[model samples]
Target: MKAAIVPALNSPWEIREVPTPEPSANQVLIKIGASGLCYTDVHITKGAIPTQFPRTLGHEPVGEIVEVGVGVTSRKVGDRVGVPWVQSGCRRCEWCLRGKKMFCQQQIGTGVQTQGSHAEYMLAYADSTMLLPDSISYEQAAPVFCAGYTVWSGLRFADPKPHEKVAILGIGGLGHLAVQYSKAAGFETIAITHSKNKEKLVRDLGADEVVADAEALQKMGGADVILVTGNSYKSASAALKGLRSDGRMVLMGISEEPLEVTGDIITNRSRIIGSMQNGDEYLYEALDYVAKGKVKVISETYSLNDISRVYDRVANGEVRFRAVITDM
Candidate 1:
């Protein structure tokens, strides 16, 4: 099987012929149909995510099951499934018991801790795979495993009211989907972006309005729920000023800079919460929207042999939204 591998830290991606892995007990072998390349792939190459050398870098993947292992009666061969980042964990662990499996000490990350799906075949725990909706294509449903799941889970965790106005603090991969999800779920959506180039694009994605910054958002009327999906803590902090009193703000991005908590957080009792893809139920809801055509995932497709080109465009911030390798 030909797999894309990062030989070492900061090394170029090479398509190498490697032995295909067989599924162990309670696992299944997936013949990857589409694998979505995330920006985190760049971090993995630079050793930021801290994985072993010669790793195949991709987590957002969907494919068909070719074989199932012992104790995997729930799924069978010839079934379609999407493999998520959190493959599985020690169920007896504290985090796993609490349903926050990603934090489990022995948690397996699909691309980071195990062999990823950027190849002809990869192994996945049968319990961890999502049954892809027949209505959604492999390319469209792939990003839902990561980008869509992250944003939708964040939005739902924030718990916006029926009449609440939702604002997205970025308009890139995650934020664009956040905007659509906000609108699809009946919230009046606003896109807060620093990129002048994305204003029109975001509006076309169903954002009720586009604000340049927190101040601009403030002038347009403060939002009841703000979803911070950009990778800038400074931007997230700045957006806090536009949060309505007693509003909720969900943090979904990662940044090195510390977020500044303003006085309004205490005086107005505004809530700030951090979230990742919360649960398998949330993952299904995220996919349901795309399956029903309530959300459109913008992506550029590449052949499996051209996986290196996907990395170059993503690193340069040239992908329109998500990039999927489909010709595997």
Candidate 2:
């Protein structure tokens, strides 16, 4: 099997032939169709996130099951599926027992703890694989496993009711999908971005309003829920000020800097706040939305051999929204 292997931190991925992974007793082997390239992959390559060398870096994946393990009852050969970030969790943990597997003490990410779907073939635990609807193409469903699920989980945390104004901060990968989900879920959606060029794109994604300046945000009179999806603490902090009384802000993007929220604003408004990723339940729900065409993934496709180039694009914010690596 050919794979683009990450040999070392800050080094280019080498296209080489690697052994095809075989399914274990409770796992299934998949012939990867597509894999989404995220900032997480770039972070892993640059050592911003800890990961082992020679690892395949991809979590948002779509593939066809080519081989099923002996005890894999839920899936079989020829089944099309999607794999998400939460690869496995300790089932005995309290968090897992309560259906919050993303918070389990022993959580394993697909690209980090195990080899991922950046290759022609990869392995996944039967329980972790999602059945993809035949209607969704593999290329289109790739980003839904990560960026789509992340935004969906973030919105779920916000718990917006019908007609509530929800603000999406940053119109990048996660934020783009956040706009769509907010619209489909019956919220009055707004997209906030400093880039004037993205205003049309955001509005096209079903955002009721698009704000390119601070004054525009002021005109909207603040939002009931604000979802911050960038790596800037400043942006997150600014969005906090743009929330209505008793409004909440969910931080979804990982930032290297410590976030500073004004104590006065938080206390005075009595805002409920936190960040969340998709648990097993959320993943299933997100996939359903994709199947129903309520949510769509906007991505640029690249070959797996173009890993370094894609990483540079993601680091420099060159990609339109998200980039996916096709294993062709």
Candidate 3:
């Protein structure tokens, strides 16, 4: 199998032939159809986040199952599935028992902790693989494993109601999807971006308003819920100031720097907040939304051989939205 292998940090990936993995107990071997390139991959490549070297760096994967191991009964060999970042969890943990598998202490991420879906064949725990609807294409289904689902889960944290103002910070990968999910969920969606270039693009993706300037934040009377999707602590702190009293703010972007928030911002307003990834329940809801044509993934498709260049594009914020690496 040919794969783009990252042999070292901050180095270009090399396309090499590697042995295809076989399914282990309770796991399945998938012939990857498509894999989503996320900012996390860039972070891992740059050593901003630590991971094993010689890693195949793709987690948002859509693939066809070729074989299943012992004890796997939910899916069959021919099933088309989406593999999320969370590969598996210790089901005995309290968090996992409560269905908050993403919070499980022993959770293993597909790319970070194990062999990921960057090659022709990949292995995944059968329990964590999601069966995609026949209607969803592999390219479309790829980003849903991470970007789409992250926004969906973040919205759950915000708990927006109809007519409520929800602001999505940074109209890029996660923020673009956040805007769409906010609209589909019946909220008044606003997209905040520093780039004037994204104004029209953000509005086209269902944002009721696209704010290009920081002054626009004050005119909105503050948002009922703010989803921080930018990878900047300063931007996130500014967003906290733009939240409505008693409103919630969910952080979806992982930053290397510590997030700085003024104590007064939270203490005076009684704001509730947190970060989240898709868990078992949220995963099902996210897929259901996609299957029903509610949440849509705005993505650009690239060939698997172009994985290294795609990472550079994502790191430089050159991608229109999400980038999916298709196996061609």
Evaluated with TM-score, which candidate comes out highest? 1
On lDDT, who's better, 1 or 2?
1
For TM-score, candidate 1 versus 3, the one ahead is 1
For model 1, give the 10-residue run with minimal summed lDDT.
Answer: 40-49
Can you write out model 3's per-residue Cα lDDT over 1-328, one digit (the tens) per residue?
9887899888898788999887889999999999888888888889987887988888888889999999999989999998888877898999889877778888889888887777888899998888888888888788888888888898987777766799898887888788888888888888888888888888887888887543576576878888888787678777777777777778888776677767867575746466667566777777777777876788888887787788788989889888888864
- In candidate 1, the residue pairs with backbone N, CA or C atoms under 3 Å apart (3 or more residues apart, or in different chains) clash, namely none
Q: Candidate 2, TM-score vs. the true structure? A: 0.94
Sort by TM-score, top down from the best: 1, 2, 3
Q: In model 2, what are the clashing residue pairs, if there are any?
A: none
Model 1 lDDT tens row, 192-216: 8877888888888999998888898
lDDT (CA) per prediction: 0.91, 0.83, 0.82
Error of 3 at 42 (Å): 1.2
Error of 1 at 315 (Å): 1.4
* TM-score of model number 3: 0.93
RMSDs, each prediction? 1.2, 1.7, 1.9
Error of 2 at 49 (Å): 2.3
